[model samples]
Target: MQLPESQVAVLEAASADEATSIDALAEATDLPPETVTGAAFELEEEGLVEVSERVDETIELTDEGHEYATDGLPEVALYEAALEAGADEEPVSMGQVIGQSGLEGDAVDIALSNYARKGYGSIDSGEITADPDAEPTADAEANALEALADGAVGTDDDLEEVIDQLERRGLLEVVETTTRDVALTDEGVTELMGGIETTETVGAVTPDLLTSGEWETVEFADYNVEADAEDVESGTVHVLRQMSERVKDVLVGMGFQEMDGPHVDADFWINDCLFMPQDHPARTHWDRFAMEEPSHIDELPDQLVADVERVHREGLGEDSEGYHSPWDEEFARALALRGHTTSLSTRYLSGEEIGEIEPPARFFSVEKAYRNDTLDATHLLEFYQIEGWVMAEDLSVRDLMGTFEEFYAQFGIEDIQFKPHYNPYTEPSFELFGTHPTTGELIEIGNSGIFREEMLEPLGVDCDVMAWGLALERLAMLTTGAEDIRDLHGTLADLEFLRNAEVTY
Candidate 1:
């Protein structure tokens, strides 16, 4: 029987009675393990050999684990210190025990979090108590960490739970390697006994081979789809971008024109036209991102700027009085990253961006907005906002609420509740809320209200206009059951979830 040289070599090295690992076959045949694996798989398909696979897991201590192995676990150290401080008999100062234990920074939190879980002690109201019966020397997690640090696999039955704990605690990393083993069948023996000859097999065709008529007679090796290869993460649209596009489609379907503007724009358009006070807390460095270089805008519509300033400083009519606070043109012209995409709505309404949008006109934007915010599960420093507005003859609070009901219903979100809220731009504004599927907690998703005269009048918009700024990530959370907004995008995003989360809505 004629076979490839690699197949012949692998069969010669494999035993009929004992299964030999691919690594062992590589050593015996003096060929690469991948080459041997491919040949072995081919032989298995031919019924000449049998192939089996098993996963071998190896555990090794992380740097932190190694430190803990040498100096003892933080929880163990805390317990020992507590016993020294007489916490075994009575409660002792947690600071005193922690100070004596020498656990600082995150290690203190780690120790306290685990101390109670291991039945080591109780920590309450700044005091700690250690159980006298607790055995620090026999701590299973500590033992597991030490064993792994000492180059032991910790395969003992009793160490399984402790090993898992150590892994969860980030004390160790477990690597699972898939190992293939090969053994010869009866047919393989007969073929070997019959003596094997080497055949030149073409794995791939070259131009010369294709051009030659001899190619028709040449033998070709079968391709193995199961062969191990490098993982390549091909480019695809992000979940957030897909959501943004879907939002654009939804708004367009709802008879809204798309709006585009600069990510960094003048506060005159972002805030001033929205009637958000120049001295508002959100305009401060605490919430807004301000630009430093070339600090103020070079040019703005003189008439529009004067109208906004007049409305902000003086009474717009006999019944309505504007904010008495100092309003500055330079302040309004100062450039900053837009905190909301509603700045586009402001510009569009003012006829500065697009010429005088007519009544019954609807416009929307799905774009990134920047703000200075602390990172958390639900919030990001930058996010995609679904900004939209409707300018019609007679708009009311009911119209705004109905629009939200219709909008959220398309995403399979029902039972949306509205709570009366306040905004500088909208009167009778309400915050939008939806129940989280996983946590069962009510989460605020967006805010909407009819655009006030204080906002629209300065922009030359005569018709009643209702507007809203919705969170795209929050909508995704409602539809996809994502508990964290970070899971959608950012440094801490879950790659697994992003790759697998279906964009249904």
Candidate 2:
């Protein structure tokens, strides 16, 4: 029978025979409606009271509706003037009728249009005629406006229909609010009959209460042990960002250092450094986002550009003939949003960033990339890329497969299927695929290959280097059971999914 003061006040104010709204209880107890609602919920949980909700829509008048109710509708005023000008007996000049109506500007037009539509009068050849049978006092819209102003619109369908019409005319607004009701249970009635007592307990120890020595005498409210709390979304990290951080932690634990670079960069680091040919179809406007303003990068290493151009125009050494199509420094210098974070790998491996690295080096980057992709369940205009590279001596495809196996195993994805693929930069590349748990369909997640000499020789990396570009969103989708990449991000993101999403194996 013991409870907080708020719960006791709510129980006393609530009725056993009928339900009382939370607002009514708050008013009786001199407490906030939100406080009363919370106390009511707690009391309901204890089986001493019941809390229920119903949605109620309230119709109210706007300023224009109030004005029309007091000053009379413009059409009504015009019709009254038309009668006074003797238009009901015969035709009167429209100018003289309008002058008698005392309506001006937009109101004059409103009166003329509605006057004819409501069968009140007619205007023909600069002459107006009013109907003798027309009664302006019986105007439905005007009566509805007055009813709303007086707060007396009952369940009459004709009045409600007029209310709808008035709403469409922008003269009022309808508000839908959730109204909660509280009612006493059998236990609450029995407690009341058994002489319920009010406890002078304090919810908090305020400064004034403490200074007044009232804190020592008053009982402080105890905290509720139940799992009840307000849902806080702003404090929760986005599921995509949570996965990004987790990926970084996993990569760092696997002995990889993080890399940093620009979201917008020169095509040199994005493609030319990857040995992607200038004439490649992907480099065209069909795939990449080309920058317009400040289109070209201001600077690039002269000798490195020459080495890359040389590797492209002719064969690297004597075994491998380069693209041999064409090499344009202008195309390489053009700037655009990076289509992949592999540009960071290109920058790191070339020692242009963070100085030269010896063999047995590992680096990775989890960052954003832009692509002009056809949007779908898995595609987005901008997405995150988990770019990584490993540099060591005597590397092969087996090493690449083993690394993938170990990495994917951390996410409980034991079945990683790799398909052989062709890439201009990598001699033997493979695409990584995983079976989606929900759809049971194989989805491509990443791509990997050993760095070809045409790509590495220009960067002065003599040893074998394995590199990969993984879709961060795809990996998140697998871990979080998100069916659409759009659901994980963008304006159409499902708020309920985001609120409850937890990344798991």
Candidate 3:
């Protein structure tokens, strides 16, 4: 039978009576170690040879261990020094022994402790004395070091205890190595008895062969289908970033335009434009992160500011009554890290930089927001929010609910429940919830409602505008079945979860 030269060499080296190691085969075949390993593996796969493995634990000396093997252990040095000082007759000062031993710092303590433990010396009243019958000779630790210095020691029960002691002292390490032994199988014996032929085969097609027109005449090596291939790792997008892209894709597919704004924004757009009062509890120092530099925004439109002030002081028109509280312009102009991406919606609907707002236009933003929050399993100081608004003429609560149903359907979530909620900006507000797949408990995913006239009139939005602000982390947690928010995005993020989480929808 025809065979590659390397494979034929390996099979001939292995014997039916006795198994030879792969290294021994390599030496007999006069082939490189790597070439022999590859050939042996391929031959084993073909049922021509059997490869057996044995793992052996061996001990080897580190730099510190080799030093001790040459100069002797610190404790031994201390014991020898005490004996030379005639400590057996009268106690020698501990400082004098340590100085003579030439050990410093923690090594002094190590030597003293070990010297006493080995019964080589004793310390009392701050004085050191060598044991009366102690003699200078190599101990088990020194013997173990000597053995390791020559070659690795394997499975010697007496030497193992010595090695463990040395390892604990940080002098040596125990390492396990696997040895592979290859033997000829019955099929291999039969093939060799029948006589095998080794032919010269081309290892690779080179540029010279193509140029000389010799490719057609030369014999090409057959590809080894059973051979191990090199590992190739392609780059992949981070799972969290991928999830955000999927959210954008779903929103874009539903005819929504993306929007973005500064993470640090003026309080006007963040709260005032949303009909939130200046003295709202959320505006306190403990709940929000206020910025120092660029302390307050001065470029806000004077007319819109006046309109917001009037709306807060009085009602928008005759239909509603305002908060009737004092409006502070300085508070509206103050800067802070936005607690939600609704600030972007506030800017867009106000038609500030986005030009005139026309009916039937839908806008959404998936961006990071910040809060002065306590961190825990479910809360992060920073997180992503999905804020969206649908502006159309003659819209109703039914339209808002239908938009939510279509949006959530893309995630394979069919069962959704809406509970009546209250927000200053939306009149018919709702807390959107979905059933947890594992626990069957309803978890709130988002909040939504039709915009109140008090909020939109200041922004010059005349039509009905349905708006919602949802937590992107909550959505990701539900989709990925993550029990804790910290496991998804923080210093505590689980590498296994991120690596194994499959992006869905």
- Tell me the TM-score of each prediction against the true structure: 0.71, 0.62, 0.58
- What are the Cα lDDT values of the candidates? 0.86, 0.87, 0.84
Residue range 174-196, candidate 3, lDDT tens digits: 78898889999999999999998
Q: Please give the distance, in angstroms, between residue 109's alpha carbon in candidate 1 and its true position after superposition.
A: 20
Instruction: Report the lDDT tens digits of candidate 1 across residue range 1-505.
Output: 9899999999999999899999999999999998998899889888999999999888878888899999998889999999999999999988899999998976876787678878999987668999999998888888777777777764667788788667656687778999999999999999999999999998888899888876898998878787667888777788888877888888898999999999889999889988888888789865788899968889999998899999898857887788899998889999999999998988888888878777889899999999865455677779989999998997888888888888887778878999999998888799999998888999999999988888778888788988898999998888788998867886446677888776666
Q: Which regions of candidate 2 are displaced past 4 Å? A: 1-20, 23-32, 35-49, 53-179, 184-238, 315-324, 354-356, 494-505
TM-score, model 2 to reference: 0.62
Q: What is the full ranking by TM-score, best candidate first?
A: 1, 2, 3
Q: What local lDDT score does residue 275 receive in model 1, on the 0 to 100 scale?
A: 89
Between prediction 2 and prediction 3, which has the larger TM-score?
Answer: 2
Better of 2 and 3 by lDDT: 2
Which candidate gets the maximum TM-score versus the true structure? 1
List clash counts for every candidate, in order: 0, 0, 0
Show pairs that collide, candidate 3: none
Q: What ranking of all candidate models by lDDT puts the best one first?
A: 2, 1, 3
Q: List the residue pairs that clash in candidate 2.
A: none
lDDT value for candidate 1? 0.86
